[model samples]
Target: MTDKAKQYLELFLVFFKLGAFTFGGGYAMIPLIRNEVVSKRNWVEDEEFMEMLALAQSAPGPISLNTALFIGNKRMGFKGGLVSGIALIIPSFVIILIIAMFLVKFKENAVVERVFKGIRPAVVALIAAPLYMLGKSANVNKKNIWIPIVVVALVAFLSVSPIYIIIGSIVLGLLHFLYIKKIHKR
Candidate 1:
């Protein structure tokens, strides 16, 4: 096979393995993705990976697929993005399809319900683990630490919609940008 073909296949296989083995969902897959893309393949530097992760989280859709698309595009352009996304989704699609086929029948089963209930807390922990890592990488120090804390409190306690938070963050970023530009002029 040609080098380009090999690269595509490698991308497919790596994401495929991640899709197949990972549990709990997109957030849970972050570390595994870091392991493969940052450590194993050396496709992106740690800083770049963190940036991609942030972008992926902010984008609309699954974080895992978004991360794959961003990294793939960065590495090999549009086709790479498409291939990585499809590969990452294929395994989950198949698994969900199979589950859907049986889920209706087993919906009322006590044992199945218990199994799902048990999985919920672990999924929460999986999601939290990535959040903690991302927060650290984001330089959430004493000066800016309260930003996330406030966001989390609003979402968790006050039941604020995340869309507002995203918009507020965007506005804050713009203000910061303008402030920096003004400083440079002065």
Candidate 2:
């Protein structure tokens, strides 16, 4: 095989492993993706990975797939994006297909119910671990720590839609950037 073909194969396998193993969705996959792309394979630097994550979250898709596409495009091109995305979904599609085939039959089984109950805490932990890591990556610190807390509260308690929160954050971020630029000019 040519070098490009081999590289594509490697990308497919890496994302396949990620999709097959990660639980609790994309958020839970963050750290693993970080480790793979940044630390292990040296595909992207830490800062670039974080930036890809930000864009991935902002886009209207599963963060994991979005991030994978970003990485693939960065590495190869549009075709790379297609390859990575298909690879990412294949394992998940197969698993979910299998589960759906028997879900109605097993949905009320005591053993299955207990298994799901036990998995809930594990899933939560999986999700939370990435939050802490991503917080650090995003440079969340004492002065800015309240931002996420407030956003979470607003969404969780007030029942505010996240679209508004995202829009508001974009405006605020641009305003902050302009303000800093003005100060730097002076």
lDDT of each: 0.90, 0.91
* Candidate 2, 69-121: lDDT as tens digits: 99999988998888889989999899999999999899799999999999999
Among these predictions, the greatest lDDT belongs to 2
For candidate 2, the 10 contiguous residues with the lowest summed lDDT are 124-133
Q: Could you tell me every candidate's TM-score relative to the true structure?
A: 0.68, 0.69
Error of 2 at 178 (Å): 1.5
lDDT of 1 by residue, 90-125 (tens): 998998999999999897999989998999999888
How high a TM-score does candidate 2 get?
A: 0.69
lDDT value, residue 85 of candidate 1: 90
What pairs collide in candidate 1?
Answer: none
- Count backbone overlaps in model 2: 0
- Which portions of model 2 show Cα errors greater than 4 Å? 1-14, 21-63, 74-76, 129-134
For candidate 2, list the clashing residue pairs, or say none. none
After superposition on all CA atoms, what RMSD does each candidate show versus the true structure? 4.0, 4.0
Residue 148 of model 1 has an lDDT of 94
